[model samples]
Target: MWYNQFRKIQKAGDLMGMTVNKELPLPADLKSEEPLTADIIALKQKRDREIRDIFTGASDKFAVIVGPCSADNEDSVCEYVSRLAKLNDSVSDRLVLIPRIYTNKPRTTGAGYKGMLHQPEPDKAPDLLAGIIAIRRMHIRAIKESGLTAADEMLYPENRSYLDDILSYEAIGARSVENQQHRLTASGMDIPAGMKNPTSGDFSVMLNSVTAAQSSHNFIYRGQDVTTDGNPLAHVILRGGVDKYGTCIPNYHYEDLMRLLAQYQKRELNNPAAVIDTNHSNSDKQFKEQLRIVSEVLHSRAYNSELKKLIKGVMIESYIEEGCQPIGSNRVYGKSITDPCLGWEDTRRLILKIAEEA
Candidate 1:
């Protein structure tokens, strides 16, 4: 009988040995807690407004998104932002600064550092308590010291609430935007949220994410909440698509942008926008190519009027030094302890060049 055959396979370990993966407790539910201060709240609002204005073209200056490719040390992150703040003022009239304060990273394979949660040395799992504290504290320090808004990949949904009072912009990485949970989270986000195309770099998925983020929906939230008002600020970030060879390229061609534009038009997407990432698939993970990508964008803005207004901003992965070091290695410098980043000199040069071109 069919039942007997099924049972034979099950008993042979096809299904009998399966184990249910349990969901670990969120960081917020842990013991360590810190209430967001009024000052932080004010700063968050100010930063959000500034970013919105810049993205919508209400602000005269071009928006330049820059920060460490990935933050591994809290002190180094704060210090880097501090220097950026001083530079931001100089370019305030010509550019708006948005610091990358990403706490979570999406790895291609193997277990990579999940940010402050598994602090490098400690390597602790389910340390939700530490992760929350570290993220909130780092955000607070960056805001207080630099007065610049922070941008992060909203990899974990619950992490958003802990940073509600600090973050200005949230990015949905390529891997998660197509997920129902992420789209739902984007819908309810209080600030601007961006959705990247799928890992394979399919543009339609990005468009779908954009539409979903902007539409109101009834979804479960925080165990008791529902009714997502929709994320109006949700936009697309073209990090490039995989080719026949199955490689990540950071190339967002004019044709790609045009097709995306057409989709936005059909959806009646408000202030339809896109931000180009200079790293990841777009840059083919090459640090130098990132600089060229920005240059090309700036040049395109000057030569192509249609693209000038459409392409709103650029994202760069940069830090104090260039290249990346293996995390487990004992001898790493100020350079990205995570992904390889452009050196500070290269970053400064590119920013100044972009400013001049724009």
Candidate 2:
């Protein structure tokens, strides 16, 4: 195995209280090995534009970002997306379904599965090198076989370059939205980026993130100085919030939407919009409530023309089977190993309903 001799400052090993592992391949090397074909490249270009149009108000169709909470197994993920591709055709008229192939997840306590970046095989030990390749390969297969590029959370902003070409939409997770690096890095991307409100559910902090992502700036990234053109497609995602007492407080109601719209009007940000997360704090982890949550969001949109334009879409957590399980033996084929999901049957029914109404 080859390793880069990182400089002296890299010796933060002692300061950070962790051992240094071998360096992985550069983003370019990984792309070369698991390259996207010309046809796949063309597919992504077309799909990405459709997503951008939804946020820019140039298209009337809504965007539904759905799929597993964490893509732990490649075969299962591909199978899930293959089904989604077939479902997409039916709802293409009113909804643009962007599958969720989240490869990384944030743990409030900072333990457990860190996602495919730490353990490509959920039941196995951590292997950073293998994890990187696994995630890239899984993403490529999802696009090539399904003809649909998906959404992944930007948990590690520095690692986004590895899958930037393969992802149509990326979210700045609630845990990372307040970080300056995540905001600055988002400003340079061309794809649509959704900055979720922090766990505290503060709209001001969320709005500040949107403003920062929509403005150009200079910052050091990946060992070099750079400037960004600012992503006009950047926007907000209301995933609800958690209070000091750990209670889930949802913000997807009509009143919440109106309150957020008022907040957007107060800012100078471009492409003012929001995507309601049907899972998470919104559903309080009751994966089944995703259906009603989405319905409520659509209902709110229909109730107010002003809000109708502001609410571009929603994010749904779903998979082959419903619910989640602890990491161990005898796991369900399509069940989630991270957060619980809405499952396929419920997901299909909910999606079709969304198309008919949205």
Candidate 3:
């Protein structure tokens, strides 16, 4: 009787041509979190403390999370972060550098190379099982080799536990910021999580997300009832937004920052802070314009002490090379295959300049 009922439902759904395709291993089925070597654990803990301190007003160091738009090439990303590690030493007084090792990329149209979390090798077809292992290994290698605790997008809330032990910061992308699961997962995170303003550019939606993330909640996670104590380190990231006409309008200006500050003040949230994403719609995807955006935000911070206090840091999309290329046989090394990004030389100059200003 149960089989007949299932068959009836399946036949009914078949009228719409729906089919269950494949099932992949759960996180527990896949490789477990590797035991952190003493050195890596210490490095991660130290970096996590500095990041949390910045959010909590315990540390005045401006946190800068910079790297490629996606971790398409592991070697290139590792090399890029190694350089950032040396630079971090030079500017330890004023800035906290967290290299981005974002393995997941959210596509607007739901097509294209999804990111390292989908294709460990961009040119190859996605092997999810291999991709999971590869991303974890890459993140671990980045921390072990460079002493830089990295940041990654929480593109899949359920996958957070896979890297929970390794990542120092996590971000809910503009496309996923308004999602209930994303907000709830962030609420459980011990490290800082940034919730970006939605692509629709609604400040209220973003603030509401922050509120949700900073509140305690009980939810079902991985087939079990879990409770979160609320993540007080949840904050905002202003990545600009698209207008109704689909044109990119910037929100990194002094006026925009001030407006965000005003809205944040009215909210009853903890660790009220925001990070200016210099790339994306803010720079109109003109990768070179990121330099100017960063400089301008720094000027705004200098002009208003309150703004300075509210604005915690900046997120820059950068890699070894500048610009981007369509994923194909002839892709450029270190250039982004997703969004255009600032090249290494320009990125270094901007970081040093920001440190000087800070």
In candidate 3, which residue pairs clash?
none
Clashes per candidate, residues 3 or more apart or on different chains: 4, 1, 0
Best lDDT among the predictions, by candidate number: 2
What shift in Å separates residue 155 of candidate 2 from its native position after superposition? 0.4
Report the lDDT tens digits of candidate 2 across residue range 69-146: 999899999999999999998999999999999999899899999999889988898998998899999999888889
lDDT of 1: 0.76
How would you encode candidate 1's per-residue C-alpha lDDT over 1-358 as one tens digit per residue? Answer: 9989975665565365673333344546432355556786787777778778765767656777788777777887888788788877777777777889888867778477767644533234545556667777788778888788788888877667777656788899988988998898898887778888887888888888888988898877777568988877888888877777987755566666667667777887766778888888888888788988888777766777767777778889888778988665564555786778988788877887777777
lDDT of each: 0.76, 0.92, 0.90
Residue range with the least summed lDDT across 10 consecutive positions in model 1: 117-126
Q: Is candidate 1 or candidate 2 better by TM-score?
A: 2
Better of 1 and 3 by lDDT: 3
CA lDDT, candidate 1, residue 341 = 90
Worst lDDT run of 10 residues, candidate 3, spans 13-22
* RMSD in angstroms between candidate 3 and the native structure over all alpha carbons: 3.0
Query: Which parts of model 2 are misplaced by more than 4 Å?
Result: 1-16
lDDT tens digits, residues 1-358, model 3?
9979976777554536675334556666554544568888888888899899999999999999999999998898999999999999999999999999999999999999899989998999888777888888888888878889999999999987777888999999999998999999999999999999999888899999999999999999987899999999999999999999999988888888888989988878898999999989998899899999999999999999999899999999999989888989988888899999999999999999999996
Off by over 4 Å in 1: 1-32, 120-126
- Return the number of clashes found in candidate 3: 0
In candidate 3, position 74 carries an lDDT of 82
TM-scores vs. true structure, each candidate: 0.87, 0.96, 0.93
